[model samples]
Target: MFALITDIALTHIAGRGRQTLVSILGVALGVGFSIAMAALMQGSQEEFVTSLIDALPHVDITDEYRDPPRQPADLAFDVAAYSNLRPREDTRGILNATEAMTALRAFIKGNAVASLKVQAVARAGGAETGISLTGTDPVREALISSFDEDMRKGKLSDLRASPFGIVIGDKLAAKLTVDIGDTIVVSSTGDITRRFKVTGLFHTGVVAQDNAFGLVNLKAAQIIAGRPNAVNEIRVRLNDAQSARDVATQIERLIGYKSVSWQEANESLLEAFFIRNIIMFTVVGAILLVAGFGIFNIVSIITHEKSRDIAILKSLGFAERDVRLIFLSEGLAMGLAGSLLGWALGFGLTKVLASVKFEIAQATEVTHLPVTFDLLHYAIAASFAIIAAATAGYLPARKASKLNPVDIIRGAT
Candidate 1:
């Protein structure tokens, strides 16, 4: 019975060859475009995220608390009003730096770097600029970030060789009119100043980092900031970057400090990506929706032309369910054919896009466009096409199943 129904469906479809072909072509185009769009969008997002992960620490532990600490009066008395209350004075920055580092290294399945950060001014001759100065151990810092790859001139090891050595962004180098071997004066909030030699220059391609950030040796930063044996931030780089969130939570629990994963730090940007994906899929669905209408038109016409045959089949003991199945089969067959053809078309388009080469306008050189070819994309595209085809075929199939043989035959007279 299924064979007979499929045979009838194929005959009806082949009978109107041109219209059927057009309908299939519509579905094919829709699926093909959808697959290519998904590939490009997902590819670009993955590339951006990978770069972000490589550039930053997977988990960052800071001296600050997630919530403000309660005042001594509030904690002791639980009173709303207090007069002439003053908090106790204490030194800032992560306390017991050596102990914390030892504890963290044992607890964490990753590399950790403790760093002192300060806001400072960099002056070279007449030109001066505000910069965020970071003090770190060069050997340890290299484990977490892509600093080695980002170095445009001189090596990171140069910082260790020259105790007062500093690495500035290439853009900052251009701004200060300074180069390697030149001297720059750095002043911190404590009004202490120190002369630092420019040992290296780095270009990370991020304008903010390149334009205003500087790196120096930990001991040198401490001396410049008038602080001894201080570290405010502990950055961790896990072997598996994806486990950052879990590790961050555990670190915060163990150390009583606020730990933040990279994902949490860039929450707003990730939300934007979510919204973009929604928009992308919505557009793809709309394309498939338009293509479904083409299938509807062709099926409706076929039903109208085959009215006499449908009535005859019904009179020959064919059930209405069988009649519906026949048309449904035709729709599904076309959908399957279109989906397969679209897969090939989409693959070709993605390959071509990935092969095209061009220079990016940014400081970094990217020769080829990013494109991901995943099987999930092909599966999603096919699912949309099949569902659209089934819906488009159903309306006309339902109407054909209800046709009365007596009326159809009498009307033929």
Candidate 2:
């Protein structure tokens, strides 16, 4: 019975060859474009995440608490109704640096480095700019950041070669009109000031970091910030970056300071990506919905033309359920054919996108468009197409099944 229904369905579909072909084409285009779009969006997101992971520490432990410390009076007394109490002015650097470092090194399965970061002003001749000055161990810093690879001029080790040497972004260098070996005066809010030589220039490709960041030796930054033997930031580079969130939580609990993973640091951007995915899928769904309308139109016309045939089949002992199945099968067969063709088209388009190359003004080399060809995308597209086809077919199938054979025959007579 199933074979008979399917054969009759195919015959009806073939009877209107042009309309069937057109409807199938519509579905094919929708699925193909949807697959390509999904691949592009997901691939771009993956590349962006990879770049973020490469550019930042897996876990960053900072000398700040998640919640402000309770007042000493509050800690000393639980049922205190305190008023007009001033908070104590405490130093901001991490306490007991040596012990903390030892404990962290023992707990972490990765390389860790401590650094003092302070806000300062850099002046060279007539040009001046506010900058974040970072004091770090040059050799150890390489393990946590891309500074080693981002340097466009001179070596990171130059910071150690000259005690007062500093490395800054290329954009900052251009703004200050200073080059390597030039002297610059750095001053901080703590009334500390020093003169340093420009040792190296790095181009990180991030305009903000390139314009406002400077690096120096750990001791020099501490001296300038008026904090001796202190570090306010500890950056960790894990063997596996994916474990950052868990490691960050552990560090904060153990050390009683705020620890942030790369994902946490870029939470807003991640949220934006989520929103983008929603918008992408919505548009794709809209496209498929439009394609479904084409199927609906063709099937409605077929039902009208096949009214006599439907009546004859009912007279020859075909049940209404079998009659409905015949029409439904026609829709599904078209959907299956379209989905198969769409997959091929989608693969070709993705490959074409991947092969196309373009150069960015700031980038040093040409790059191809990122495109991921995941089987999941194909599956999703096909599923949507099939559902659309089934729905489109079901509406007309229901209408055709309700036709009274005796009435249809009498009307024809």
Give Cα distance to truth, residue 215, candidate 2, Å: 1.9
lDDT, residue 79, model 2? 75
lDDT of 2 at 376: 99
| TM-score of each prediction | 0.95, 0.90
Tens-digit lDDT track for model 2 on 1-413?
78899899999999999989988988889999999999999999999998898888899888899997876778888677867877556478888777877998898888888999999999999999998999999999887899989999998988889899999999999999999999889999887999999999999888888998999999999999998888999999999888999999999988888999998999999999999999999998998898899888888899999999999999999899988898888888788777888898888888888899999988888998998989999999999999999899888998999899999999999
Best by TM-score: 1
Instruction: Report per-prediction Cα RMSD to one decimal.
Output: 1.8, 2.6
lDDT of 1 by residue, 231-319 (tens): 99999999988889889989888888899999999889889999999999999999988888988888889899999999999989999
Clashing pairs in 2: none
What is the clash tally of candidate 2? 0
- List the candidate 1 regions with Cα displacement exceeding 4 Å: 83-90, 364-366
